[model samples]
Target chain A: MSCIPQTDLTKNRIEEISSSLAEPAWLSKERRLAWEKYIATDVPDPKADEWRTINLNSLDLSKLKTTKLNPNLGSFETALPDGGKLPKEMSAALKQYKEIAGFIWQTEKGTQHVYLDPDLQKKGVILLPLSLAVNSHAGLAEKYLTKTRKFSHDNKFSLLTEALFNSGIFVYIPKSVEIEKPFLLGFDFVGNTCEEAVFSRLLLIAERNSKANIVNVLLSSNAKNINASPSLSLVSQLNELYVEAGAKLSYAELQDFGQHVFYNSRLNNYVHKDAHVDNLSVAIGAAQSKVDVATYLQEQGANSEVLGVVFGTANECFSYNTIQEHNAPDTQSDINFRVALKDQSKSMYQGIIRVDKKAQKTEAFQSNKNLLLSNGAKADSIPKLEILADDVKCSHGATVGPVDPEQLFYLMSRGLSQKEAEEFVVLGFFNKVLAQFPVPHTLEWLQGIIGETLCTQFQSQAELKAEAAVLVK
Target chain B: MTKTILTIKDLHVSVEDKEILKGVNLTINAGEIHALMGRNGSGKSTLSYTLMGHPRYKVTKGQILFHGKDLLVMPADERARLGMYLAFQYPVAIPGVSVSNFLRAAVKAKRGQDVPIKEFRAELKDNMTKLGIANEFLSRYVNDGFSGGEKKRLEILQMALLKPEMAVLDETDSGLDIDALKTVAEGINSLASSDNAVLLITHYQRLLNYITPQFVHVMHNGEVIKSGDSKLAHELEAKGYDWITQELVAQA
Candidate 1:
């Protein structure tokens, strides 16, 4: 391994990172090209509709470090340096999910724990760290990693992630192998004296006729560390999902970072003939977050559903851009995004449903609803529809307003205090989308986060366990 | 002697600076059912809203006493806790809140404690059976996509669960079919007792036929210009409220 000076983002630093990872020739060359593209791309025009609410100037890429602190790997039975003690949030999540097919935990240092069921491994399932996958399964890695370059080119942060991703995971399910349980992936960031930057890339491929569910969680250490001056962090994540013909995949992502973390994520789903993909994203943390999610129905009979829930409190800011693209005949897609803001929080939601000319018999629907809980809170919703085929059906709706006084009055008349009434309405606002979540653990986790954000009384771990037992019964 | 449950003395209310209830005076006693008859804009609904403490309906110069305590100073929720309930004419829909969950919360607030799940479920089941509501209605969102009769039934269901001492039925009989009206009227009758009173507001006398009132007051131009036994409602229903307005004009 060659040692390079950790300085600002530059061509030399990119080459050093590529060589240090000992990546294959093709990947190294691709990273160089992506670096070129990253430099050539311009910051979003401030006057543009999508960029008006987002301020990127505060993100000083040069001041953030991209070096991995720890390079060793551990297994589920024994995670190193901490004596097998997981972070509090991750430990809670682990206890919540009693029957998971696999688990992977990655911190700023490196992969700390990994576990896969022996049965799945016997069936030719491969779940490995990205750095190891490129060498052990180089052919598969090159194929999918190259395909991810075709999306989100206009996003400079996405290109930067492509060129300098230091940590990642690779998941592959062979043909006809159905995993009944979900795989849990956790990414944690710990703050130190310097402003650290994390670029995580995930490539998941569900082969033809295979099925799987994956839950990805992004969390950070304590807020006290994050609030320390000059100790901020920037997290840039890129996820590429490929649902082969007749395959099904359910992917849920929950982001709960600290107060000083700036988060940017881009997810692209490539769905093939007769394949179905359900994607749910819940964001309740982070100082500022910008997420781009898109699904491409590339073949006939393809279906995709996208759902998002965001609860912002304090001065947290969130922006979401979603697209549902139908490129073939008889394709269907739906998008529902909801956001609730309190205190001085702000949110922006922009969605588009695009149907190609040849995509006849396509049905697409998009809706966004925002609820503001205080005078200082604000939300902006913009929904667009582009249908090139006359035979296709497409519709979109958007609403942004404070809590309905009439609804509040109705609840109050039923005997709830003002605070309790508002909390009930806010939770109810998110209920429709939460009900569509594929995993029960994810739903419960999201509920906990929302309850904490609303300052509602939190149940103890024992109480939650008892509640789960009752639910099971 | 019957104890007084609600007393309104020289009650005047305004909505958006326009007087809606001009100097209304009325009294209701325990174990008594009072029917309030008026035209659409005669401030019958305003009086109900003012009693329940709706912020939009301001009590400009009025004194409302509930069980001998000042009612105007309390908020809507406090009034609810004080055993006051209003069956709205147009109950607002709360999406994503299941009927069971909302009812549980309301019951908890009214009783100042969480009802045991088993007991809550049993009571809900019993009430649903009585109201002709399906078992599936417990999980459905509150008033969302519910039929008019269903909304009215849910209102009465709330009354049953809360068991308010002073209940105001504001046009509860307006949108119900004959069968639904009978069911709701029966629900009201079952809940009324010697410890509670009912103030039934309606535009027609059809509901009184099912649930007879001990007293009926005809409100014309925000004032109770005529009061008598239930015969007063029958007279107004037959005479079309014209005779009362003409009598008031003649008296003026």
Candidate 2:
């Protein structure tokens, strides 16, 4: 672990990533400027909300590399209908990584893909790699580069992401054009053997009357296999999902990383008046992960839905930070998050709904529910509301407890075993959060995964109650 | 010895520091039905609960023996599995669990093994029909949004499925209409067996009209004051609790 020396990220790596596609010089300069912004912004120093009552000194980010896009060495193959059906176009976009308006890391073996519908290309849509966006579409890229993401936040991981940042795509849907299919990018992160780390960045600009769905998935395979052969992969992606007077945008990120690496991600959005944005982030599995997602509602009827779901178990740690900003009058935002914990796993949910004075009639709601099924498992939810608008309705609540005993006993008495009874109670506990996001199949998948984890980390009441009494008393 | 299944000797119990039963004693043998009738708060339901060993009900200077073994020594679940069942007067509703699943668990707990799916469904359907329960009720949550009569029917339906050696029907006829009363009484009558006994706790003598009891006992302030044949129930119903109280006062 101590044999490797620290390396500094310079303009060369950024240029190489852009020049690999022979991207014009202007885009390369913009990449350099974005890297400079990465330098200027400090890493985040988590406040009480992020790490309350928890210790996280084991996260060290000093010795890591800014890696190149070494796509996974394999053709896409999967019966799973999601992103597997279109391998031909995906591979075409994969090789032209630097040429596309938006560049993203694919989940399959360092697979990287881009989105460029020929029709939109004919309409002069400046969608390509972030480097190209900076060089070729400098005016638009600079104005929106770090507009949504907070890279300057005080944190070592943020600083590392900024320092080593290189990959990710840039997308801009020109005025009055519609792209029906979702834009997807997968990143496979394996830090060890390759000695290369990833800090992928994305910039998305949807002009007035433009419609699109950008779906990016972050993944890591254990290929760079050796332990602390450590390549730090941090992705600071920006989604300036502009919904001009009449535009619509849907952005989603799925983080399913290798069970042995650290994943640091930050995503944010800025929506304009009369525009709509929906952000859905699902984090199913990860070794150690931190996600920051927020949306700024800038004008009247500028609505946003910020939804997140996470699963944490065994030694996994999940920290989530969400900020919903209502910056315009009649603007609305809804934020909901649910976490399931088992074994020694831990998850912290800290979210705030802020309503500025000018943002009157802003109705904001925040809720966090945690299901703790093990003696060693722990969950903390810190919900906050800062309202400067006297006319706004803002409220937040958090709940942490074991399943209801009476409810469990009642079910057990009917014919269900003790385990079956508890499963029902736990499912009922998060029914409210599930209602906000009407995706039942995803909810069922999450429920099954949690139930299996509960089976392993479970101890009967005799074992847990006695242990709890001794500790609390 | 006529195979006495339940033998209560001076059973005194209290719940949460309040005395419910004071020196109550009763005995019933298999192949016979015993009816314990009393007014409200006479400890009729309390005796049934204490017999099942509810954790909150502490037995004070008493012994509840079923088939010559102490009932107070076992947990509620074990008591249930040991062939003793209670048909709750007001069934407790458990949300988010289907009726079929709940009944299956109770049966398994009593039988101590997983029942085969085919046989389980056939028996469950038969019991539901016997209790006048609709097939759709099996899919809904346990007693959630069920009517008063439906809850009572479900309780008795459980009694039929568990087939306990002895059953304590606590006011199972309280909230039933004429049709429901007839249906529930018929269901109970159909389950009667020479190998099992029934302890019917009620506030009315009307239910006994359809399903006759071999013996009847009058409970006053936790003790059985009078015991007689089925005609005793008719005589009490003809008059009222006041008639017996007045007679006792005259005798004293």
Candidate 3:
């Protein structure tokens, strides 16, 4: 395939990354093909209708260096150098961070560590690094990895990540195996490489009748509040999931990157007949982020519930796009996204529920509710529904407004301060979606971050109000 | 002297630049139940919300003293923490917050500390049972999808749990049937004690029949035009509020 290259990304860098990783010839070919697709797509244009609303023109993609692959490739739970000294950049974020699950921590320096349940391994569950899987389970990796979907002609970022991703994660559950414990993956960025743009891929597959829960947490070790710069940190990741017939998969992703990081991620879920997929996403930290979640109900009796909560503060910008595609008869999908923005933050959400022509008896629902905590904060919710199937039931609702004054007053009349009152109301607003989270500890972790954000935002708001009060005097 | 739980002096209030409470004054001492009855739009609910320090209800001119402290100067939450409560006529619905969770939060805020979960659960159960409330109501969202009677009972349930020094029931009897009304009134009557007072703001005289008030004050056009004992309630119920308005016009 011949295509004109649009970005400044060079083919030599792509080849160098592939050869340095010592990937198999077929895997190297896959990388080249993805690079071709990435070259064919133009760098996202701010003038385009889809990109006009998104603020990516300020992002200097050229200054972001490709991540360097660490040669150590240590075992799971390997200790860091310097007597296991914690990275200075991440000490504060760690203090506020609560442990969700025993995660496989992979840092930019290639320090990979994990605590996999041996009992699960005994039951024929496979949790291995993606590069290792490419060599050890090549057949499974080739068949399942990035095979369910093709690269879109317009999504250059996905193609870019697929082409140059040096660190990848792979999880597989054998037929009839049901794991009670969750599989956690942590991608932590360290070092002072603010110019490094990290690309990662995660492939999760559940065989027929198998069930598993997976949690993917993306974060940077740096805690300092930094501004967007030409050398700003960027983490672009792609997750591909396949649930076979009668299988069940519960997947969640928590994105809390550093203050200066720009994150773009996508999750594509392919659910088969009689299968079920439950997805919960929580986005809390990032200077600017764009996330997309799409669930395809490909067969009858397949169901998916998508829930998400976005809490942004300060000058952060976040945009989330979701699609619930029903392609078969009797398939159902429901989506709910709740967003809270404070200070000068901004959030944009665009969701669509598409029922194909043959999809009869399909039921899909989409709802987006937003809360603005300050006058400078803003949010846009655009919900669309395309129903080609006449028999399908589809409904969508989008609301963008401030926190309900009545709810605030109600909470206040119960003895909570204005800060506490707003926090409680926002928490309650997200409780319905969080209730869908399978793991209890994960819910607790999300609630903890939400509480912290609310407190910080309210404190700043009080200070601003005091300043204004003084000016009036 | 019996301590006054709440005292309102020359209180003038407005909502959306329109005057609501026009020079209203009242006082309720501890251990007493005072009934303030008025027709619709007569500022009965306005006074209830104003005394509770609602932000929109501007107190243009007045002083609200709760236990000798200036209530108007304090935030609504502070007043609530200081042992004041309002049973709203149309309680706001908080969709995802369950009744039990809301109560626990309210209790923690009121008491300024965490209530042991076990103790909180037990007290919630006790209060719910006392109000003839079912256990399932505790798990449902606060006032969300609740029937009118259930909302009233939940308000009573909260009042029972907080044990506020002064409880203001703003038309708590509006949407209740006779049986539900009796049950709610009984719940309020039990909470009235020597250390606490009850302020019942109602338009109908029926609620007083179940929970008798020590003082009955007829509010006409935002002022307490007449004051008497329990007999006053029956007299108004029979003669109707028209007589009070007629008497007020004549006096004016």
Please list all clashing residue pairs in model 3, or write none if there are none: A76-A114, A77-A113, A77-A114
How do the residues A382-416 of candidate 1 rate in per-residue lDDT, one tens digit apiece? 88788898898888899989889989889999899
**What DockQ do the predictions score, one after another?**
0.70, 0.23, 0.77
Q: Better model by lDDT, 1 or 3?
A: 1
Candidate 2 residue runs with Cα over 4 Å from true position: A1-4, A7-47, A65-68, A71-109, A112-263, A267-289, A302-318, A335-347, A370-379, A459-473, B1-252
Candidate 1, A388: how far from true, in Å? 3.5
Regions of candidate 3 where Cα sits further than 4 Å from its true position:
A1-8, A47-50, A77-103, A146-153, A191-193, A225-230, A463-473
lDDT over C-alpha atoms for residue B242 of model 2 = 86
| Deviation of model 3 at A89, angstroms | 16
TM-score of chain B of 2: 0.97
Say which prediction, candidate 1 or candidate 3, comes out ahead on TM-score.
1
Best by lDDT: 1
What tens digits encode model 2's per-residue C-alpha lDDT throughout A1-473?
11234553555666665655455555555556556766676544555557542234433444544555543222322211233443323343333222323334443123434445565678877555554455667677657654433423544445445434455567778787776555656565545453345665666777888887766656554533545423333334333455666677777566666555566666667788788787777675666677777778878988888777676666678888898889899987888787766668788888978889899999888878787767787888887778898998887878887665556544444444566566566554443344344322334433454445345434444467669999999
- Write the candidate numbers in order of decreasing lDDT: 1, 3, 2
Instruction: For model 1, state the Cα shift of residue A81 in Å.
Output: 16
Q: What is the lDDT of residue A110 in candidate 2?
A: 36
